[model samples]
Target: MEAIANGLILLMLSIGHAELWTSVINRTHALKIHEVYLKRLRHVLELLMVLFPLVLLFAVGLSDPGVLVGGEWSQLPLWWQPILLLCTLGFLGLIYSGVRHQFYRPPRQQTAQESELIHLRERLKQDLIGEGPYHYLAGLPFNEIFSVEFTRKTFQLSRLPEKWEGLTILHLSDLHFSGTLKREYFIELCRIAQEMKPDLIIFAGDLIDRMECLDWLQETLGPMQAPLGRFFILGNHDWNQESLQIRQTLSETGWIDLTAEPVRLQHEGQTLFMAGTEAPWMGKLQDVKLSEDNAADDFLLLVSHTPDNFHWAEREGYDLVLSGHTHGGQVRVPPFGPIFAPSLHGTRYTSGTFFRGSTLLHVSRGVSGIHPLRWFCRPEISLLTLHSADKK
Candidate 1:
């Protein structure tokens, strides 16, 4: 019976030791994951961490009493129990050291100037586009090509004539129109865009950053008119968890609300269908049901908040898709690119125009900041001019 008790004690101690080590290992693993970009892995590790403690509790319950007490003080030497406990505690300390060494320490830090310069460049890129004339007056940076000197971006239509080459589409995105930005900034941008005489105005989303300011925003944005029409879609930030009063305000002002719906526009004998999809982050709140058959036209444009929905847009036979929400990383790192896209697809198809099969996706950086400050990737207004292939 004594031998059996000894055997049980050893089994319990072994499991208990392993249980403690496993917990330390899990914590170390979680810490290591922070160094890498693995959101899913992080979640899994968190779940394992909780489960491991429960497993340890079960192990403790099943363990022999003497094993936990180290064969007892009376039965063995009086010092044995405390010594065994100390040894176990010492073992735990060793495991903690191993975990700390293997995981917790941060990577090497860059020099202050190097870090600052990196930050400066990122800010420069983010703030390079999306400001109006006054934003420039405020000392914003814009690429020379997108500056007033260039004024326009031309695209050659696959099959069309030279006369239609000047078909201009003014692309504005992520208005973030709230108290944060001066109301005049948007009014000034609208005035400037009106002066440009765009054939169409496409607003990708986030008309109001906060739902409370819908009335003020609608009044400010309502008068802005384009020769063709003004179109808008829903952005993730559009749906404030409060009541959706913004949606009602936009509808009242004749803002062609395209949240999860399709609108067809006919101009100069060519038909173009504009479709908007549900914001991916919204899950079931998205309510778009467009098919290519429904958009049987010369051109199809899909407007979305995030670009990961491009596959669906392409499959639906969209000629182009315009989106925002990357903010060009809102701060970028040279060569490394934007920090992220805010989509499950990572940084793919973020903050620029990309060709996906026959579909063209233009991911605008945005017009305003959630905060007035911009570091690298500034706000932008995109002037897209479509050129007919026949002209050239």
Candidate 2:
């Protein structure tokens, strides 16, 4: 009984210590770390972490530690008693922190006015193209199936203008349309999105993966209908293809390219100023300067491919920002959230809605990825309804 108790306490301590160190690495180095090397290191660390407690138990048992051998408290070495007590307290503290973070933390409130059923056809087949042998060997091919979840989230802000109340915007991003994802999949997505009857449509870049899918854009994306208008910005992946051609194609399809310029529109008696910036990775982010004089009483909105611009948007007094790029970290782990997110802040701005001062940032998980495998992270198309908190 004594040995068993000691072993359990030691195990908890080991787990707590491992988690603390892992968090340090994830928060500090994950963004800068190389993918393959980081993955390999994480795997090796996990294996060693799990085996540590067992190895420690064996060593203590062989040495016949007084505490493990059921010796009286007073008979145990004075130093050993304090060490055990400290370890036990540290483990309990870790447990308390975990419980508090899980149940007591105040998460941002997200209210949904309505959500439509994600209609997936029964005959929709899973098709994997150009997938390497590693995918099949690792059972990742099963995760490559194209599916979408349509979410309608309402954001009520006290600062929101009453004239723009109940404004619905459809947000789409990261349509990594490589050969793996078929044209029909996007067509189905657009069909469902059109049914939402959004007042405006915003595409936050990474619309195409390769040049081969360029024709699919006009055939599938052209049919999307919106009452107000459609706007788009380029992402890192968009530059992989001919950026000029993509911009021209979008213009020809009646989609306004908001890159590097702010456009003003009158909607429902409200003045809306929508602007976009080139992705920071593309070296043209500086060109997207917004003029203070142009903002005149207009509801300012920005479209950025990466959430890294959230700070800039907030500093410039923008009310809302739509962005994508992290793809919700591609794979999310419960409680711990995303294991990796490609940003300077790591997983801080990976996905979902966030508030920076008065600026609200919505980061989409995206329509698709370079590789189709996604676990616990579903592809998303969001319908955002903006409401004035002051109205009610």
Candidate 3:
């Protein structure tokens, strides 16, 4: 019984250590850190997450430290003391985060959500980029990378304008375009987008991961259009590449650049605002002032590359906010949820619909990532339909 108890304690402590490091990694990704440096840091941290935990489990837990190291706990090496202290603190953090996860509840604005899974590989019948990077993992027994989830969510907003009772926006973000998933996958995704036939379309960010795949946009997102407009912003991944050229190409292809200032449009004879921010990567939150009288008609929609800006959008009185940077943690562990999300809030805003004050935030799971592996989390294309919950 003591051995089992000790093993459980060590396991929890190890999880705590990993989660604490995950927070560090998540916050670092939120900044403008170099990809190469961040990658190396992640590798080193991963090694430490394993090595440190194993050493403690074997040296202390198994041997019952007080017996092996002579009577008092302080008799152990000085280094071991700090390690033990950090482990205990990490376990506390794990318990706190776990409590938050357990109590997570969606806001009342989310009326309903429906999902459909599309199997691109079986449907296309042909090999989609045969033997791309990490092809073995792609074929893992239950890997969900290729299985796309087309989710349609309904948000009932009390502040919605009467003119736009039912407004649909197809939000597509984080199409990494790394050549790992192949061209057909993206083309098919675009085809489905066209079929949805939304009023407007928004590509949040991270359009191109590899510069070589820049031309692929012509066949994929280039042809996609909507009645209102198609707007886009560059993500950190795109910023790392030739962002100017990528922006130019996207602009030439018909998508409006929202990375600048807010754009005003006339829809249903009511004024609407569209804005984008790549904060902590490209720029900061935009400043805007709205007339109190026109609040009924002026609907502000902000596209942020990361959900970290959700609170900012809420405070700024945005009607809707769209984001996709964490990619639903790329891989999720059920019951415990996602372990590593690239946001300061850790895995809290990884993905899904969240409501804060008057703002409704939708974080997409995203199409793909730089590293091509998705276990329980499927890539998502969200179609958000906004309805007026205002009785007046």
Best by lDDT: 3
Can you tell me which runs of candidate 2 are displaced by over 4 Å? 1-109, 113-145, 283-286
The deviation in Å at residue 70 for candidate 3 is 11
RMSD of 1: 15.1
Estimate, for each residue in 1-392, the C-alpha lDDT of model 3 and write its tens digit: 55566566667767778877877888898888978899999999888888877676667654645422333455567877676678778777766766766677768899988999998888898766534456566666787888899999899987678878778999999988877788988999999978999999999899887788999989999999899999998899998989999999999999899876678888877778878898878876754334345455688888899999899889988889999999998887766677788888888898888988889999999998877778889999988898989695
Ranking by lDDT: 3, 2, 1
Which structure among the candidates has the greatest TM-score?
Answer: 3
RMSD of candidate 2 to the truth, in angstroms, is 5.7
Writing each residue's lDDT as its tens digit, candidate 1 over 67-149 gives 24344324544554664464366445444443432342211110011011112223234434233323443354432222211
For each candidate in the order shown, give its overall lDDT on alpha carbons: 0.56, 0.71, 0.83
- Name model 3 segments beyond 4 Å from true: 62-82, 130-135, 287-296
TM-score quality measure for candidate 2: 0.72
Residue 9 shift from truth in candidate 1, angstroms: 44
Which model, 2 or 3, shows the larger TM-score? 3
Model 2 — which ten-residue stretch has the worst lDDT?
Answer: 130-139
